[model samples]
Target: MKVGLYFGSFNPIHVGHLVIANHMAEYSDLDQVWFVVTPHNPFKKKNSLLDDYQRLEMVYRATKDYTKLKPSDIEFKLPQPNYTINTLAYLQDKYANFEFALIMGEDNLKSFHKWKNYDVILENHHVYVYPRISGNHIETQFDNHTKIHHIDAPVMELSSTFIRKAIKAGKNVKPMLPEFVWEYLDEMNFYK
Candidate 1:
């Protein structure tokens, strides 16, 4: 099976994330799309994130109904400040029968070159990119790269940071999240 790994902190899983993952699962050749909840991203600050399991629970709540979508806590066991390349290598070894790919936004593509062992990632796996509203310019080397496939998915500007801020401000951001996720967050009283 071909699986696409969609990595994120998922501070709280929202509809925008579901849309993209579902689009990749349904519109692309990937048999499954795993939401790899990162425990700690090297690029992001730890204080802004919820506990790893909480974020994973939110992802679970968001993807439970979709057979093609899954929530993975693979990074939780990995070393701190793990890189995508390391996770990719680990997954490749563990699931030898399954082919793994990456699902990313166009904005990430702009800085793809800066990632550790990026060339190795490109050499081993395919990258599926969805459009972003950001104005950043993508690297020229990736323009027509055979390993990279640009998917024409919807442009999702909705973000977890925006949702968190709204919740802290006592705004109704319920509609931005999945019903179950919203209920979980409401029960847990997160962000507020």
Candidate 2:
């Protein structure tokens, strides 16, 4: 089976996330898009991050109805400061029958070289990058071994930070998130 790994914090999963995953699954060769919830990203700041388990639950809730989209807590069991290369290695070892590809925003592609063991990842994995407002400028320094595919998906400006701020301020997030996910967030008082 071919799987596209969509890694993110998923502080509170929203419609935008689902849209991209659906797009990838429907339009690409990938059979499924797994939301790999990262416990802590080495490249990102630690402050204001929700608990990993909580984030996983939100992802689960958001993606429950989509058969092709799965929320995975794989990174939660791994060591802190989760690295994509390490996760890819682990997944390959655990699921030898499955072929996994990386799914990320165009922004991440710009700094792909800064990631741990980037050369190995580039050589081994197929990356599907979706366009984002930032990080569209690609450098010509990438190695030839990397297989990068650009995907065109509708851009939703909503972000986890903005959603969190809205929730904290008691503002409506109905337009930003899916109906069910918005309900769950309100019931759990997430981002409060």
Candidate 3:
């Protein structure tokens, strides 16, 4: 099985994430797109993030109906300050039968050089980059690299940070997320 690992904090899963994951599963070579919920991303500020379990529940609620998409808690059991390279290495070892690829936004690709052992990641696994609204100026390096794949998944201007701000301001962010997930958020009084 070929899987595209879509890693994120998923502080609260939203439609943008679903759309991209669906696009990858539908238009790309990946058979499955797993939402690997990171407990703590070294690149992100951890204080504002929801609990890892809460984020996982939201991911599950947001993606439950989509068979090709799955919510993964793989990072929850791993070490803190999750690193993509480490997770990729671990997944490669554990799921020897399944081929894994990294799914990320073009913006991330621009900053890819800063990641730990990025060369190893590009060498070992495929990378599928979806375009982002703010990164049109960024040029993809290693254009001739065999494992890098640039795909045209729809660009979603919406972001999880905006969604959280909306929710905290007592605004309804239902349109930004799957209905089930919004309902779950309401029930839990999350981000209050």
Cα lDDT computed for each candidate against the true fold: 0.92, 0.84, 0.88
The TM-score, computed over Cα atoms with residue i paired to residue i, of candidate 2 is: 0.90
Q: Across residues 73-191, which tens digit of lDDT does each residue of candidate 3 receive?
A: 98887887768888988888999999999998888887888999999888889999898897464676756678888888889999889998898899978899899989998998888
Q: Number of the top candidate by TM-score?
A: 1
lDDT score for residue 22 of model 1: 99
TM, every model: 0.94, 0.90, 0.93
Total colliding residue pairs, candidate 1: 0
Q: lDDT by residue for model 1 over 89-161, one digit each (tens)?
A: 8999999999999999998887899999999999999999998876454665799999999988988899999
TM-score leaderboard ranking = 1, 3, 2
Query: Between 1 and 2, whose lDDT is larger?
Result: 1
* Candidate 1: clashing pairs of residues: none
Find the candidate with the highest lDDT and give its number.
1
Q: Which tens-of-lDDT digit does each residue in 21-126 have in candidate 2? A: 9999999899999999888665787666877787887888888888999999888778876678889999999999999999988777768888899778878889
Error of 3 at 62 (Å): 0.9
- Runs in model 2 lying further than 4 Å from the true structure: 40-47, 134-140, 143-146
Q: In candidate 2, residue 176 scores what lDDT?
A: 81
